[model samples]
Target: MNLYTFGKALVKTALTPLYRFEVTGTEKFPDQGGILLCANHIHALDPPVVGMTSPRTVHFMAKEELFKVPVLGRILPQVNAFPVKRGMSDREALRSALKLLKNGEVVGLFPEGTRSTDGVLKKGLSGAGFFALRGNADVMPCAIIGPYKPFRKVKVVYGEPVLMEPYRERKASVEEVTAVIMASIQKLLDENSEK
Candidate 1:
């Protein structure tokens, strides 16, 4: 097996005891074709957690700084991660994601662009919306619920794919798609975070 698969199993096995991973709504996720897994950013672990819970390999758009962090820098690429320069339009990163999606790969992204220290959902960035529109992949909204508490449940909810058909048909704006993504994530958190 590849390093990505091996690491995924290893992480899951090790963390299962420390945290209860309750994943739901995976049935709503598309089984094939390209997918953009957009989720709320709560912590640094969110990307790996999302990767493990996904039914497919997730190519995460990580921060550029992460790729400069010694061992993590080298390891991130092996695990299907690419760097994105935040705060401005990073066209290179955008092209990379679009290429992956065009080739029927799953790309994971945090709509908020960075981790939320308070574990609250932040406004979705238009950059994420650009990825959705340009990639032409299934825009699958996701949510990772709960603060990092030892021995507590870390719930992940994958909401149904956003209806990008109409958006694509009319060539809608990026902000329009961002709004839909944020709302879907909020809905998932509201319904599933209680338990």
Candidate 2:
């Protein structure tokens, strides 16, 4: 197996039991081509949880600080993660993500830009929409629930892909596209909560 696949297997084996991990709608993930996986950020585990459960290999946009850690810096890139400066638009990171999408790779991002301390869905930054529009990629809304305690059930749900074609062609405002993405993520969370 490739490095990413091997790492994913190792993570799944190690954490699935501890987190009681569950995943759904993985079939909704596209088998090929460029796509964006936009998810809500809660805990630090959110990225790996979503990434491992996804059928497609996801190159995640992670905070730049994480890359500074000695060990993480070396390992994250091997697993398809690139660093992004938070609280501002990092053009270099944007360019990298765009290039990945252009190559028909899946890029994962948290629209909220940062983890929510309260676990509440927050307003998304415009970057997600910007990438979707520019890359002509479908945005897949994903929700990750629970794992609040060790061995507690943690679920990852992937919603239908939101086609960017309509918004892209109409030149929709960044706010509009971002709103749609946030709403979709919220809806997924809401639905999962009811279960």
Candidate 3:
């Protein structure tokens, strides 16, 4: 097996017994073509959980700092992660993401930019919207709920893909497109809150 598949298998096996993990709405994920997986950030563990549950290999736009770590720096790229300088537009990272999408790959990102320590969804950054419009890609809103503690139930829900055709054709502003994506993510969060 490849490194990603092997790593995902290891995580799934280890986390399943520690947390009651569940996944739903996976059929909504596209079988092919470029697509963006936008999700809300709740914890550090969020990305791995989302990646493992996804139907395709998810290339994450991780913070540049993670790539600074000796071992992680080497491993992350191999597993499809590229670093982005947080709080500022990193042109290189943006180009990388766009390139991946253009090549029909799945790129996952947390719109909030960083993990929400208090568990409240924060305002989304405009990068995701920019990528969707520029790359002519579909955006899939995903919500991850809990695993707050060991043995706690954790759920990952994938919502219907938000087609960028209409928004792109309308020349919607970045903020507008971002709002639509965030709203979709919020809806998923609300729907799965009790689960």
Q: Which prediction has the highest TM-score against the true structure?
A: 3
Better of 1 and 2 by lDDT: 2
TM-score of every candidate: 0.96, 0.95, 0.97
Candidate 1 Cα errors over 4 Å, as ranges: none
How large is the C-alpha RMSD of every model relative to the true structure?
1.2, 1.2, 1.1
* Residue 149 CA displacement from its true place in model 1, Å: 0.7
Clashing pairs in 2: none
Each candidate structure's count of clashing pairs: 0, 0, 0
User: On residues 115-162, what C-alpha lDDT tens digit does candidate 2 reach at each position?
Assistant: 898888999999888898998688999998874588888878999999
**Candidate no. 1 TM-score:** 0.96
lDDT score at residue 71, model 2, on the 0-100 scale: 92
Give the least accurate 10-residue stretch of model 1, judged by summed lDDT.
Answer: 127-136
Q: Pairs clashing in candidate 1?
A: none
Model-by-model lDDT, in order? 0.88, 0.88, 0.90
By lDDT rank, best first, the candidates go 3, 2, 1
Assess candidate 2 and give its lDDT: 0.88
lDDT of candidate 1 over 86-148, digit per residue (tens): 877888898999999988899998988778888878998887778788887879989899766
